[model samples]
Target: MERPELPLAQLHAFVVLAEELHFGRAATHLGIAQPPLSQQIRRLETKVGHALFSREPGRVTLTSAGRELLPAARQALTGLADGLAAAREAGSGRAGRLRIGFAASLALTVLPGLLRTFRERFPAVRLDIQEMTTTPQLAALRERTIDIGLLREPPAHDTDLAFETVLTEPFVAVLPTTHPLAAQRVVRVEQLADSPFVLLPRAVGPPLYDRITSLCTGAGFTPRVTQHAVEWQTVCALVETGLGVSLAPASIRRIRLKGVAFRRIAPDTARTRVAAAWREKDPSPLIPHLLAALDHDPSDGPRG
Candidate 1:
């Protein structure tokens, strides 16, 4: 035989009647008339296959079945209430998992502070972080593999994706300690015209790679790139071994390599940008909350 549904309304009525042990009082507590409350108790008892209350001449009292049903009914109502509250929290972006993709280099700079602030604001939200390079991060955002991306040098035009610049830092010179230019407090781009360059390949980060090259070109010489490394640390390691010099975002200075020196570029006008990216019309509410957190963070640079 098919099971009868234990409707919440009926169970609620049962618990209230069990507590009051009086039809009129329980109906008053439930904000209903006495007859409807009596009918609810009768329906619940029918489903339970037992009489729940004994209506005597002067007093109403619980049968053994009603006593047993009270606690379990109360528990079911409490569990439903908790579940509904959690669902509301998740809908408001205060709870749930947020998948994030970021460039590897950003971990050394803005990533830590951004994540800390997000966690403090929404402690119940779980962060799923993926470290990837710029191109891959963009692809991940497009594929829905990541909900958002923190990457350097977002593309100039993408109809399906939207980007907001979150950080900008001027480029600095990376050189071997023994290089003559390293002795100077600041280096000029034109000064490195004769030196070999160790840089991240254009394919790895085209916009950043092109920006570095343009700086050299503006100084009247194209960089003679003798070595290519996919990561800034590796590029710095090559420079330390005297393979060549490089120009990188100021944050690259955070990598402490004894043999390499990072010096400010004179006139410091040119800069590389880092941006937060997402699908143009992403439906996840978490994205806005995260963007708000990024905006309020002290470490976030001026938006572009």
Candidate 2:
């Protein structure tokens, strides 16, 4: 047999009567007269192909079928209400989840404070964070996998992504405590040009690695690279082993290695620019809240 189409109005009346078990009270709750409420329930019973309630002189009792349908009817009505609310929010540009990407290094410094502030302001917005390299972060932003990015550098390609400088961090030299240079108050990049160095991995960005090498060159000689590591922690670990010295952002000083000593790099040859990037044409309500959060600088020392 074909199922009859259910009317929303009759469904509402059925739900009310199912709960109150009295047509008079149900009508009062629905703000309708009892006669019309009774008529609507009768009509609904016809459509459903079964009597929902047994009507005696003074009392009304639900039939077995009515008991079975009550929960389902309530669920359907609740779902409809929720769907309507979500639609309204979407139309107003105030709903949906926002996915944000961040480079690993930035997560140690600025991301936490930004996230805390954003959550406080936009409690309804869902935030999803992905930690990725600068290259992949830009790619994710372009592909719509992420709505925004906190990264060390601006995008290399000319996509429609806009970037705002969030923070600038100076460079510091990391060396084993036993190394002679570790005893100096401040070390210059040129002074370490002849020392073995642990370099950032080539995949991190040849340009960035070359920039480090170029700084050494400008200091007067080529660096003797003794090891290569992908992450700042790995580079610090290698330095602790007396493998070589490395130039890293001042934030790296936060990562305490007992054998590793960090000193300011003279002339500040090591500095990295960090920015918040997003797609120019993307529309997301949470963006403004996130931007506001990123605008508030948190006073923190570099360590991770």
Candidate 3:
């Protein structure tokens, strides 16, 4: 059989009266008239089906029933208080989970510093980080699988999503260490016109791929296609084999392949931009806090 529900007011009065052992004093502590205090204790005792206090002219004390209920009542009140505090913290964006998606290449640049800043400011919030390419990151944000995204070359027109540019870096040339252009301090856009080009497929990242090809076109030639790789690391590795030359964000220099060299592109006008993206109409308090963290300057320290 299920037990009956006892009102919190009765339980509170019972505990105070038990502690004080005097109706006058308990009523004073609870800031009520003595009659109401007595009535509350009576209601509680009736609910428990027992007389809770033994009343004598000069003395009052707990019956066995009241003694048994005191500890449980105190525990219930404490639990409720704790639960309320946790709810408040979650509502304030100081606690709960924040899922983020980021491009693989960003790990070499702004990802770490942005995370460190957010973690420091909201230490109790749990971070769920996923490494994905630009396209996958966008899809995850739309599907609500991720709360924030750090990606490169955000789409120009996406009404469902909003983006903020966090970093913009110039393109650099990646070539075989033995290549003649590698010996020079910088490579011009036209320098690699006739060279076999190792580039990412447009399907993988349209904007970034178009930027590279546009740079070549602006220099009066279309790059001779030779190889395609989905990842920058793979692209650089292919270049290392002397299969072709490639252009990548300056941050790609962090990849340490002994057979490859990274050189600045002269005129340096072509730059890849990384942005933080999120759904425009979704209301998540954690998203705003993360956006604030992104406002801090990204770390420019030496790459690993």
What TM-score does each of the candidates earn? 0.84, 0.77, 0.82
Question: Order of candidates by TM-score, top first?
Answer: 1, 3, 2
For 1-304, candidate 2 gives per-residue lDDT tens digits of 7878877888899999988999999999999999999899999888878999999999999999888888888988999999999878755546768899887776678878888887887677788989876778878888899998887756465558888777778888899999998999899887897789998875665556766777788888888887998778889999999899988777788788999999998887456777778888955666776777777646533322
lDDT of each: 0.90, 0.81, 0.87
**Better structure of 2 and 3 per TM-score:** 3
TM-score of 3: 0.82
| Superior candidate under lDDT, 1 versus 3 | 1
lDDT of 3: 0.87
Candidate 1 Cα deviation (angstroms), residue 22: 3.0
Q: Candidate 2: minimum summed lDDT over ten consecutive residues — where?
A: 295-304
lDDT of 1 at 269: 94
Q: What's the lDDT of the predicted structure labeled candidate 1?
A: 0.90
Clashing pairs in 2: 171-270, 251-302, 254-303, 255-303
Q: What clash pairs does model 3 have?
A: none
On TM-score, the candidate that comes out on top is: 1
Top candidate, metric lDDT: 1
